[model samples]
Target: AALRELAAKAPDAIARLKGIGLSGQMHGATLLDEAGAVLRPCLLWNDTRSHDQAARLDELPAFRALSGNIVFPGFTAPKVLWVAEHEPEIFARTAKVLLPKDYLSYWLTGRMVSDMSDSAGTAWLDVGKRAWSPELLQHSGMRDDQMPELLEGTGLVGPLRGDLAAELGLPDGVQVVAGGGDNAASACGAPAISPACRARCILSAPISCTALNG
Candidate 1:
């Protein structure tokens, strides 16, 4: 496949690309169907040509308050806007827009979804409810129709689509758990789950030791 070919050539080409100031790579997988056909080329997160859209969103204090994060051109909504504006042809062809992990889940299960944590990063979700935020979408010049359905982080999105499973040499009915964003997963991997414990360890390691003893 094209990706395999790219990967094979990347090591040699990456350094040269870096030298030319085109060093960035997006960390997402391209989804494929049961027939091993590419659904679409995966959009890389570092594609930041949506600076205008990002700037407009960033100007709104509501964006930061609602999303609990600053608007960055690298995030999904801006990227979506970029596609809509610059690549209307591709945008028109898109059946679904998904984050990296969700795209993989789609390939595995033939389901399209927007996981809560990833949605939170998109500037398209109501952070408190963890659902699509219609107001944010409207403000961003996008419609709710353009967004994927939402799913809780621990919820079952679907099972692996049978033919895809067989083709991948995986068993049928592999459960596709709605996954969280990279940050949320990384937090779950930490030594302590509690905020106080983590804060103590991070702020004062000696204090964490004392607290552990006492």
Candidate 2:
């Protein structure tokens, strides 16, 4: 309906769209069932119910080795572990997991994918390698099949699907790029990534600071 309204107001809007770059809550988790339906309400980045699980995960040297960061209740990995322990049925039904922005991308492009930047906060990624960590997955009680394919932030994951494109009045081949998480997206175009940048980041208050390279 909103699409129709947008199309009514500017029929060329979608056609004019060159690409979609998304930035969203870094740790929110969306679990998808085998049929591609959402298994449950997403456990958002701010949800703190997973603290106990996160504390337990912090004990694993393997986890610290892979992720190079401390586990937090706000991270996706422990939240998933929380779900697995408290809601086994949902975990059993999950076929793929996505971060918040990836969930929107899945709806738009029908692809299950995530960018390295967004994936980093999941504590399921090998941050140094910028890829998923199988050891972390196993420790989290997740299988390889339950993770989305990882992509670089600027890599093209797919083009708009035919039906969705038609419905949205978008051109057939509008490219969809893998987007970073909220902080990473903000960090991408800054003029510099010096100690000054990091300093200002601390002053920014409440913003998640991540590593940035030129």
TM-score of each: 0.70, 0.86
Model 1 bad stretches (over 4 Å) = 1-40, 93-95, 201-214
Query: lDDT values of the candidates?
Result: 0.62, 0.84
| Superposition TM-score, candidate 2 onto the true structure | 0.86
Name the regions of candidate 2 deviating beyond 4 angstroms: 1-14, 189-214
Candidate 1 lDDT, tens digit per residue, 1-214? 5433554567455223211001112223233333444556765666677879789888988788777777888777777666667777655555455677776666656667766767777777778877777777777556676566887777787776778645544444557677777656644555445777666554343113323432
lDDT of 2 by residue, 13-78 (tens): 655877867678899989988899999999999999999999999899977888988998999999
Count of clashes, each model: 0, 0
